[model samples]
Target chain A: MINNEVTKLLNMTYPVIQAPMAGGVTTSELVAAVADNGGLGMMGAGYMTSSQIREQIREIQQLTEGPFGINLFVPNEFHVSEQEVELASNRLQPIREQLDLQQKEQVDIPNFDKVSESFQQQIEVVIEEKIPFCSFTFGIPSKEIIEELKQHHIILIGTATTVKEAVENEKAGMDMVVVQGCEAGGHRGNFLSGDQESLIGLMALIPQVVDNVSIPVIAAGGIMDGRGLMAALCLGAQCVQMGTAFLNCEESGAHASHKEAILHAAEDETVLTRSFSGKWARGLKNDYINEMHEDESLFPAFPVQNKLSQDIRKAAAAQNKTAFMSLWSGQSPRLAKKQCVESLMEHIISETRKIGRKV
Target chain B: MINNEVTKLLNMTYPVIQAPMAGGVTTSELVAAVADNGGLGMMGAGYMTSSQIREQIREIQQLTEGPFGINLFVPNEFHVSEQEVELASNRLQPIREQLDLQQKEQVDIPNFDKVSESFQQQIEVVIEEKIPFCSFTFGIPSKEIIEELKQHHIILIGTATTVKEAVENEKAGMDMVVVQGCEAGGHRGNFLSGDQESLIGLMALIPQVVDNVSIPVIAAGGIMDGRGLMAALCLGAQCVQMGTAFLNCEESGAHASHKEAILHAAEDETVLTRSFSGKWARGLKNDYINEMHEDESLFPAFPVQNKLSQDIRKAAAAQNKTAFMSLWSGQSPRLAKKQCVESLMEHIISETRKIGRKV
Candidate 1:
């Protein structure tokens, strides 16, 4: 029963994939550990430059002979005025002051053209490196890009938040689709559905997406242990993509304070906020989130707001001040444990087998 | 494998409970059909009078030999000014005109004392009629009422939306707790957690509640079929309480227009709104909800706002206009089917067994 189409396609022992979380969370060590443990490990290359991506692919290759995947953020056209950027940056003056960072008059703003070019370079690196598996988030790639990747014999996965988006991905020639539920951490993968409409839970999302699309469906959200894997399978998902569970692993590059915050958080403590990035993301409640709650809508879109908060997030992390850093976590923080990837993978596999025996 | 503590306590063949969806959805025929099919059928008695409650209990007893349950709404103290009620009522003038209902100068509003008195009498009917099982929503009952029910050998269940609330239910001596997820249709049962915080999905909620409380957790939300039933069990829930799935059953007393809206809906079509009532509820988006979206926070609390919209809802239903009526549904509308309760129960059971053999 464990040997399904997803396992065979991915050439992994289990239908488990470590979700590609952006930023510095997915280190080479973490990806290699997950791959060596017989699960698909995905490098979070959303914010990495082309050279950084090439270097990491080489590093992971040295650590493990097993296959690993890489995820890229599909750049979306964002409109932001210089005045709006300045206003948003000034609004964060107090936070920057609190973190003892200098107030700069000039900030390196990201234009859509530059962002689009960066995404192309990242995709080129993936093709050049011949990564076995590749996934795209935020939005789907163009026909040319998808065809180029397929021509290299690399498996393609698309992230979606609704059935309509899943159908779109299938029509766009994606090999598989990852349906992200509302319980997922980090940035939402909703490109078609509006923010309010896209917040579908896995219980409802999995079955509906499974019925609509013929391709394999991967469930991603608050899944933590073996129970979640079996539950997702029963809901008609062929595989499970976990984020917060792997974010707390020993090899993960997440800040110490971020991991500690998730370890102490309850289910209800995490909330959605667009303050950190123009896009909505779920994280633990902290002083920065609370202080910026009221002005979340006034900030500029995506890469702009994300760039504005870079210095503050960096300074806070360096000083070990979790209250100012973005502590992304899913709703099931209570089930998270600080451990090695090998032990976490073993526990999940064993638990899946145990539940199989009982049910 | 399905005969767990909850099944034994509720004295049912299947660990399925027809959720007590208030406002005339749970008809005696629906309750009896579920009970005859070996699943626990619950009466939605939150809005029923004492006499109505007593009459339905007797009618259900005649139709089915198996045990059934009833649910009550625990009254909370609401503060609203007479001016606030008038303004809220006037805000619905457009909807009332659309429904062809005459707008009244004064709307009869509910007070805390009267709502509390009604709850006490509902409890009296349950005890006097010797109902086998009882559940409470909105919040847990007082200590005296809990002890009184226990003394009569009535199995008590409490509704919770978070781990803290589940722990509170266990401390209050509830035999079992229903952990309602954000994907649930109709009104939210959150009391302790705020609106945003209580929106945890079942993928996160079930496991956390299972770890925190000793009582068996009954998973609610977007669960629709045997896949959901088995998934809940794997998540450590002893049983499942389904609302939207049964709401579409032929035996249910929901308006035909309401059922039809759900049948044509998609997973992302349902949204959470407090426009219909003072409290937040998940339902299909309609003209009425969209009109009141901006002024949602200005309305009075439950029972009061629920009372203010009564005339419009009734007229809309009478005229077959679903736009102004409340069409409650969970996130899994695509899986909904227009069938009898017996077929739903049978399908869920057979599917559970089928999944058990495969997994």
Candidate 2:
């Protein structure tokens, strides 16, 4: 029964899922590699438009016939007040002056319209493409949308931080829940109320969710290798989704500097900060994170704060200045290997088997 | 330089040292086992008398001719007023009644005399016995005592939570520093105060300490297996120290229930709570710790609270009630192997070598 679920998700002999990290880092090649290796490879479409996501999904199909997934960021309308944004923007004026750029007119609410438009269009594409699996992050998609996706026989996985969220996802008729711990990279998926209480890690989160809900649980966060994968399974997770580990793979589209930073990162080098997108996310601690932490007024709410700092981030990336870029990675980034996706998956599978035998 | 320093102190091919856990868990057999495996074995003398410590050390010596160390809990004279203890005791009255105990009486302060007597006597014994290493926790020992111990040419290791503590240890002429992170199992070693700002994990702590001071840095806390060992080494730690990992081994003296609890523990199951020892320590979360957290007034200072609850803890352990026992373990206890010391170390060495190659 376990093998059936595992094989169905990854189209592999073993059930392991490589997390899709969008924004050009998780590439079609990486997705294809995981799919080819008998695990599910997901294409992250957080920053991409519907057309871009379509192209990436089609690109993965071109290389492999195995099952793959597409991950989407559910549009969140929560925004910081106008006063908060101006206060945050004024604090960034010094950096603006330092960058020798003209200060743009003050805008109260940050633009989230782009995100909504992209999400809506991406859903249409998923329907048209008949994507085998789809996952939502940040928050649960609307019931109407979930029903629509279910009608097409799509495997719907919802990201959850707490057991309550997992139960809610199961009640909403989702196929599975990804129990994201505090140790996970990227935006924390605190969709339901009382998300802070849900900051329970994968170790505690997986088993409790498994015991509480009747659905299969997928473990995420801080899982980097076979040992982690095996441990998750032993703790009741049917499969594991790894994001930061694949971020450094040769098939990833992450910047060379970003990959290098991850390879050299110590377990302590990562910190959970909201400096990047005005939402709590884990990344390599650098000057930008440090500055925002020191002066909270410098960071606006998501999309707004995220959009305002987009130019500086791009400039920093172009200049290879990693201290200012969001080098998103998990605590186990140091264990990540610089190898092709197929080899990495093979290594993970073999290692997990060894761990299983030891257990 | 690092290798030589490590070899000289622990008298091992490698400098890895395992932290001593108290309350009868870290046994003489466990110490001897680690020493026999070419790492420093330390007997925790936190709650034992001078004679008991001497006997434990002698027991370890009889088991292995290899070098071993003794760990001491430096006296932390936290002056919680009588009223406070009374208030805390009053809060515990309900539970005390349930256990059929009389109203809590004034438990005398555990004499600091025992600590000094034990230290002075242990120093003489170590010198006479020519023990290779001695480590201190809770706080640094007196400079005069440290200097006296140095005269015996005994290797000294001071535990530190922050870089400042590491620097202070070096300034005090200690041989090495065990960089204990916030994730450490037993009581925290936050000597150089300020709300414990350094919250640094092993990965970040080791490199920063290595960069800041010119001494061998031994990393501790949350390190369980070979990947952790390799990751610490890659971060510039001379070696690694693990307590909870060793506690699950066959040689460990921890209660069978404690061992079972550790084996069954998940990643996020451990939490930092002051409920057990008046001082902050990490252990498997249970009803006692949870209740204490919910009712802050129900806990007294270290030694006092620890002394008062000793009977209850013993009864709980005797009854095989996991919810009432201390259950000390780290976040990665799930990764620990329930095997003999020799086989566990062999697995660690092999796994470490495999991961080391990738780095």
Best-fitting candidate, scored by lDDT: 1
Worst ten-residue run, lDDT, model 2 chain A?
A193-202
Indicate the TM-score of model 2.
Answer: 0.64
lDDT tens digits, residues B1-359, model 2? 12556766578755567678888877888888898897778888778876787787778778888878888777766666777777777766665665566776667655456546766776676667776688888778888888888998888888888677888988888888898865567678877743324445443355557667787888887776665665455445777898887888999888888888888765556777777677777788888787778765457777777887776687777777777788887656556678888887887777755543332
Q: What's the lDDT for all of these models? A: 0.93, 0.74
Residue runs of model 1 more than 4 Å from their true location after superposition: none
lDDT tens digits by residue: candidate 1, B195-304: 98999989889998998999999999999999999999999999999999899999999999899999999999898888888889999999999999999999999988
- Worst 10-residue lDDT window for candidate 2 chain B reads B194-203
Tell me the DockQ of each model, to 2 decimals: 0.86, 0.08
- Over the stretch A191-227, how does candidate 2's per-residue lDDT look in tens digits? 7744334455454456567767887888888777776
In candidate 1, which residue pairs get closer than 3 Å at backbone N, Cα or C atoms, i.e. clash? Answer: none
TM-score of each: 0.99, 0.64
Best by TM-score: 1
